[model samples]
Target: MRRRFAVLLAALALAGCSRLVETDQARLCRMALPALSPPDSTIEVVGQHEFPDGRGLRVVYQLEPPSPALTHFADCRFRQPGRPLRSDELTTLAIDGRPLSDVNLYFLVRFWLATPEARDADPAPLGDVADLPRLPRSAAYALQQALNGLPLAAIYALLAAAYSLVYGLVGRINLAFGDFAAAGGYAAALGALLAVGQTPATILAAALTLGGAAAAMWGIATSRWVFYPLRGATGQQALVASVGLAMAIDEFLRLAQGNRPVWVSPMLNAPFGVARAGDFVVTSALDALLSGGFALLAGLTLLAAMRFTRFGRRWRAYSDDPLAAQLFGVSPRAILAQTFALAGAFAGLSGFVMTIYYGSVGYAAATGLGLKALVAAILGGVGSIPGALLGGFLVGAFEAAWQACFSVDYRDVAVFSLLAITLALKPGGLFGVRS
Candidate 1:
């Protein structure tokens, strides 16, 4: 028994280590600031740009107030793709385009290991204005805000899709959509932590896989217990029960994790300087591009599948006439379960992007997020996927404009105001048919 237990422990340890490796390139990039300094002088990293192929990094930094030339940089070169350098393999170091002797490199490494930033390599940008294109002040500000808001829009769009899907099939809204998203956010953070390495590509893959799967499972369970019982009830009754379910999820998360926010360290948040107006500049990051692009791709793929597949035909048939679909041998419970699973998957993806882009997910984050998504669904035309997507972008853009032109305190108010206007004037959404 003792021997078998020992072997089990060893297997578990190896499994953990297999996924949590610190790659050679990640180690070198973490030491970017220290690599370019001698430990005696104060230096800070201003900008860091990775090579297209991921084997090289150009770190741009500056010395304290009085310096030799205002700016200096160091290029940390790595080996070819398959031949990654080991942690101890980096012997020679470069500082301000000059080679550092082995002796100096020794002290720098020791000092870096002692620093806080070295321990937590958060990818939050340190502001970049290098090589920014000239643009009018207003244009630059607008562009900057839009770049920041793009990811938020993607997140909203995804959550909105969840609401639309459920409403289209069941004639009821899932008020717990935000909590589902929050659950996905936590799962995604765990996925990143368990990734094979800190490389952007690998981490992204792990996060998406785990996050989407977890949320889909959560949705299935929710539909099983929560919505299944209410199938024979009125829509208002289901809506009220869903609201209660939302609160239950929130309380459960709060009690389980306490009040602390949970998330993985941000990675690849370095910005690309886009345009500038004097000292003011606009920047965007690859993180935002990946967020929006992946969301758009996922949304398009779902649309295509819905349009081209037999399953899509059945789903549409069920949505149009449940009695007819049942008469044709389609199961209502099965359809409902599948729809919830898909919605949960979208919500999970949204939460993953939110956590990755924003750096953390708090317990109460779901409340406001759910409210905004519900508004998006209603404004765009509830029960319509394309409408939800368009509504999400519009809401995101509106929030950006409000934050830029006015104070952010009333952003929610503005959004709710839009909801009121839409309901009062349009009644049915852009795609939703009027009763």
Candidate 2:
């Protein structure tokens, strides 16, 4: 606690001293589009250019006399080609000789929609003023993009941490972890659905208990039946076995549910206004509150399991050395079963969250969830629980951020890049000790 406090104090001091300062500046020039001869052209001729910040620009010419033939005049949509414009954020505005209504205008400004302080400090145009417009990537813009992902990143981190614990103790990258999480979310949804008019407390308590128990059962079954016999097999064989288990579970779910994506009622769903920061958007009241609660519970549960319980101690002993642990009269099989059950309970709980809060779930839900959690575990340093959680969040946040800036299709790229970079720089992950 003292160390954390000291670090917090230092961070506060640094924040207090930090200010937005522009390291360099360049000229920003505008391009004028040629007048349109045919006023009724279906396509508005907009010139595309970029700023030093790599922001895209569009230039539209307005006709002096508004033409009735042109029904759709393009407006100044300040964004680069192939980039999705964020709602309410400022982009470049173009001034052209064409009638504002007749010719729709657009410009790609490479400037980031940063905080007022940041904008005020670095108002200089980026790049040389030239006839043709120029665009470049901005450090400020990239930083802002990164910040936008922090909240979701935080949530993913929490999941990763929880997953790491199971991995550390079980030494099996339980493919079902994501499924269990999905189950938790579904259970929460089911509970809420059944208790529509009940008080919030009753709904939450009942849902958690029922859902959690169900998940626990799932975990126990997996450990006792599937994973135990494969213990003597090499890690590679175990990996294959896990894959088979995942396929079987998914198929069972598919048979039961028919492969439809189901939506669950979020126990707490309220749309609140989010304050937009430089590039990052802050979470609203409910998002922040729920995320905080989940994080706290996950952390405490992990600590309690590791530090206070006999089972936990035995689990640790087993994790360290199963042979030694068995000599001490610890039943490795029993412990393994228990651990799987516990992990499954967590997954079920996650299912509730995913279905209710996130509003989506399907039989194959674990496919992505399991892989990402695995990545998170590995990134955080496999065999390290906290590391798993941290890795999960990092992967989640990065995926979110990358999707926001680029295409959602690029989400995989973002995760893989992080994985590669982490492996290259710190093979053990952010939390794992040097191997």
Candidate 3:
């Protein structure tokens, strides 16, 4: 608490000294589309180019609503800065990349001139200086989005591995892992309620810790009490039980926390430019790095333990032949309990990531996540650890690329299509051994 208070005080002191110092490029924003500022209009700067003189600016902007054609791209060019543009200086005004007539350019400028700020700021809004903001990333948008997709990829990898871990051990799918992730979110929320006035970083850290602990405990209990009883049962029986468990968990949380979604305060979201393409820059935030790094460490730790530890050997031996493992005095019940608990912990971490990444966690929202993780597992080879990781990365990359390059409405369609193609072409998955 004291540490958080001290940090808060320091941040406030820093903020008090900061001011909105506009960039040279932002000076161009106003001229690029003063059509942006009046009442209901929304502006998004999509691309920018600077002439050799540096004073000459050309940009592409997307304007929404009240705009002539509803979310159409428009182009603007200015030959001289720091003063109102002359008739010859307003070089181009185009819609959808087709240059409009000089009369249309004058008309748009006239519309901006009607605004109160433009009128107050300049005697001649058409001939006076104006601006909006920094010319942000254009070509770098895809790179930035791809970079952002990594944390989500890590989360999916963790969830996919959880699916693989249980499937390899028991030969039965535990569909409740996604629900377990939601349970972890609930645990985080409960912890957040107790942590008053703490910094966002501290809150996130605490949430993760509490979430993992609670989830591991529940996983252990469920495996021992619910799954253990079904030792000799068929796969469908266990699968149905898993679905029931998921529903019970969802309902329990809905009843416990109410129907409204639990919102998480966003943190560490100040983007810092990291790379550039042309004049466009790519940016990332500290939270992404922190979360992604943590997930990587967790994944590496799990892989190492599974590959080199006595537990790993025991697990592999049991997976190969449970009867032989029992003859060797290995308790099947103990192994099942431990494996499920580990899987639960990973799922919990995944849930924590999802909540923080999206800024909220919902009671029944994780069903899709679980289903997707299952697909990721199958796509990579259901029982293969490394395959799970690869599948998750591929899925995340696919979604990010599709969303960046094409319409977002079809992103899911693309993912499901990939799954269908993979299943049809390679039933055992990329890494799965032929049965």
Candidate 4:
């Protein structure tokens, strides 16, 4: 068991390390701080400090000799408000009464701004912008990113649940599940094109119906043709077939849709600021909210049905022991088909909402999206609905937070690394029962 676990960790580490290849100096500089130094210049972070209220951070950095001239007078830039560093805010560090090479800069970065309403109503204006009560950018940015992660997490959760449900029922992984999502996305895009100039409600209805139907059809076809015949076969045989089906589906999609991304114009484009803390502003996109809400509603409904309905009990019985279920007059084939249909519907709904939120879909994105959902399922504990939700949120937040702090290229590496660590510690997942 120990050796096997070690091998698993090594494999995961290699998977993550493969992407962390040597990057260009310019790219590295951008990942560090493009605002402070040129690509050729050497810059080192010496010290850092955060305000008690979490409104800002002060970064002290040392620059090598022959450094580029500082164009901006201020040490810090307010990214949210798009404000340049002011002359009054500049601070130069000196060593033993001698000025350091070029500029030894200390940055006081503020994240939040005074409310617009308060600013407008202030009878006595502050002399300097620094005098205005500001909110810490770190807190605000973190909050904003956390909120942003919700919709993505919700999508992941839905897909993860689907994967879990299928796996629990059949004891075989459906590698082609992501392709079902891609099918749904394509269907939604087609529906959008066909429903052009229609009301938002009509467009949404059409897209959902088309996308869900496409996914349901695909699921039914696969279960009946590929899986049903191999029902008595080994798990390895079923897995191989699923993988082949995934590749075939991917190729078919590429051939049918071409390589270009299909764009889906959102029905409602009105986005307004939903929350503000200091200078950090959080905008609520209609599609994101709708997607998150739909996922939550769908998940809750499914849980309720599983706990309360006769079909749910029968499904659970079949999942636990198909032979026993058959002995009790429950047809495993019918239940399995229904399970596939339900899983496909969930995947389809996710794809439809994701396309609407993102405004675009690509044939190639299916694999990554599906894999992430699988990761979420594994992280939460395979076959656990609530666990899937937790895993989805964690994955989403992990990605969002990493992107906010570092380069986007490393986001996947970070996610996989975290997964590897989590699995290493808890092989059964966060909520899975240990055998």
Candidate 5:
């Protein structure tokens, strides 16, 4: 029994090692494709696996030209004898540019292997390959993409919630909310680096503290300097001021951090497969768990605070009717300041989680994230917290699904299309009360 267990463990370890090598070889093949092909050519890795002889590996890729008049199919085989693999004799198949056929093209490059050996081996097909195998691989890729999008959705949800909260209270959008998240991420990253010798728990605590404080300070500063002065002005004025403030914050960050991205150490980098079907695998179970867990906790906490806390009641009252709330002795200025501070804290925490999830933060973080969060807030109903959460997940899921079924470049188009449709059908969003 002991001997059998030991052999089983050894076999598993060897399998794992082999898989890692195959992955590395496939990545190399992908990296080499651009250099080997035309400048405008696009290469997609469809499938990769070790050859039946266990002495070589095969990587299948599809190359589509910019004109789409001809598609090239080729196989990259890396042999065990350490010989460099080349794809010199690729097969080019012509196809109509309009309504392309899904004929499931394949390319088999045997590298140094003889024609007989190549004939005997069956190589895995790439992503764009035809039916049967393509279904499972596409499904697996879609699942992985969805898992990737979850963290992004969670981050967007946090920002969306912040947006909804402030908008609910003040009836004005804070364009700088994304900047608050960026500030928090930077602050937390710096703090984590400073506390490198500390335990994980200690480092996390310090990061959260620093990030939240930095975001809160930024929120307060902006409110005092920008929004406060425009308190008596119209919503458009406040909106313009917030945009200017956001631009200034972005510029300041660019000046301070330079244009380079700063990488934060991942809290969890090890990925495990949650589901597998034959050669297709869906991984990153740990990442999905962490991202979903954090988002859920944050959402619930905010929900409870709003439902039961005194501050939440005042906020709701102000959101419902500011004049009435002011008549009822609720200090509008105090509520606005508190709302900004709370929203900033949420934004900061979002940044902290985003850094850990993505392992990096950059100046361009705000562009995609901010726009998505704004969409999420509007989708969920501008002032509804629950709606924001729902909207975020929907947006994330939609993006992933679009990438899976179609081109990733069209993901934003899909999202915006959905938004337009939703607005056209129900202008109040998924949760906002219709006036």
Candidate 6:
């Protein structure tokens, strides 16, 4: 038993090591920040001006403060002030080149203005042309916010849903699910390696296809050879095994990739810019690949399988009861193996998107993120497709709000808190109908 366990440990370790070839998107983002050395300058309203006609006026400023100049402000300021600005007159602020219709922008402006210096001083204002009513935002602003958060929300939702699917089918959470995400990335890296100077689309397709296949292979081997045989094992045993697997992967990745992260240039190099709204500057990209892309794909794949596929029927049967599924001429073992393969495929898809979106992959790429997905799965009701989707969106939106409302550091705390609250309120999760 000891030797067998040791062998199992080794295999799990190798699976974890594969993650070194592909890192998590979040890890990449954290890594990139230090390397990128993005310009230092919080978005702040420096000056606002009103046109003589009191009609429409253009506000201009550089997104990043120019270097070598003490205070980086675009020299495009009102050379001669003529119009008398009323104290009660409402003003709007625009960041970079974005319009003055963003809420975050406005909120930021309000916060900045609330400062002692801003309150006491009469800083130049941007727009005074129109006497706009202080009411709900125009449709344009709402559309922009929705579009801004859409892709991010979709990615998070996909991860959450994937977690729920695995948990629902396996009755156990896979801590290394994030590795699957990384796997797709590494697959892309491998594509980059193979494609060399090939077209971006060709390279991405290669990565997506091969990465997904590799992840599926890994999942099948691990599930059939290791986890499945240990099905009757205690939860503690399984948890330990999973953790051991995770550590083994981490160590292997460290050995293979060293301590450095690699970048994967985006397949679609969309020119993303900062949008200025009511008070904040937000990253906005018109050419951005919508978050719905993969979700729609996953949803369609799932719906099609559930509604039409024989494998889906077998899966549902096995999920209902392995013993009963086996008795009815279905092979539960085979079904389980296939299920792992399918789940791993989605994980690989996630990995590809992460690599493209974040631009790098690292050793601890998927660290702790899998757990977040698990929480979402629990919150949304494991095993239900809609539940997973709903839970993922909830988690993603919550995290986004947390990051926006508070510090980025506190995002995890908020997510975990929500998870805890959800569990306390509904142990079975929001959509869990099963007894």
lDDT tens digits by residue: candidate 6, 94-209? 32333344464345345543344443332212223132223233443544455555555565556666666656666776777776666666776777567543444455567768
Residue 241 miss distance in model 1 (angstroms):
1.2
Clashes of each: 0, 51, 4, 7, 3, 21
Using lDDT as the measure, the top candidate is 1
TM-score of each: 0.75, 0.62, 0.68, 0.68, 0.67, 0.64
Looking at candidate 6, the ten consecutive residues that score lowest on lDDT are 20-29
In candidate 4, which residue pairs get closer than 3 Å at backbone N, Cα or C atoms, i.e. clash?
Answer: 54-136, 55-136, 111-137, 112-278, 112-279, 113-278, 113-279
What overall lDDT goes with each candidate model? 0.76, 0.55, 0.70, 0.66, 0.68, 0.56
- Candidate 1 segments whose C-alpha is farther than 4 A from its true place: 1-132
Instruction: Kindly indicate the candidate among 1 and 2 with the higher TM-score.
Output: 1
Best candidate per TM-score, number? 1
Ranking by lDDT: 1, 3, 5, 4, 6, 2
Tens digit of per-residue lDDT, candidate 4, span 120-165: 3221121122322244777667777876787788878888888888
lDDT of 3 by residue, 1-435 (tens): 466357445754443233211122333334445543455665655544444443444555555665473444544455653232343455566656688677766665565543555434321122211221234466467668878788777778889889888888888888888888888877776665555235455566688888887778878988987789998999999999999998988888889878988876454444445555555556665567666677778878988999999889888889899999989888998999999889899888988887766667887777878887878888899888778877877787777888888999987788788778888889778787655
- Which candidate, 5 or 6, would have the higher TM-score against the true structure? 5
lDDT string, candidate 2, 1-435, tens digits? 466357445643432233211111111221212222343333332222323333333333233335543322222433342223242233433344233332232222222222333343321222212222122335434444554554455545545654665667655566666666665655665675565444445655666676678677777877778788877777777778777777777777678666677654343332222223343333233433455456557667876887789988998898888899999998978988877776676666556545544556676767777666667777889778767766766676677567767888878767767777877898888777666
TM-score of 6: 0.64
Q: In model 4, what lDDT does residue 184 have?
A: 92
* CA-only RMSD, every prediction: 11.6, 15.0, 14.6, 17.4, 13.9, 17.4
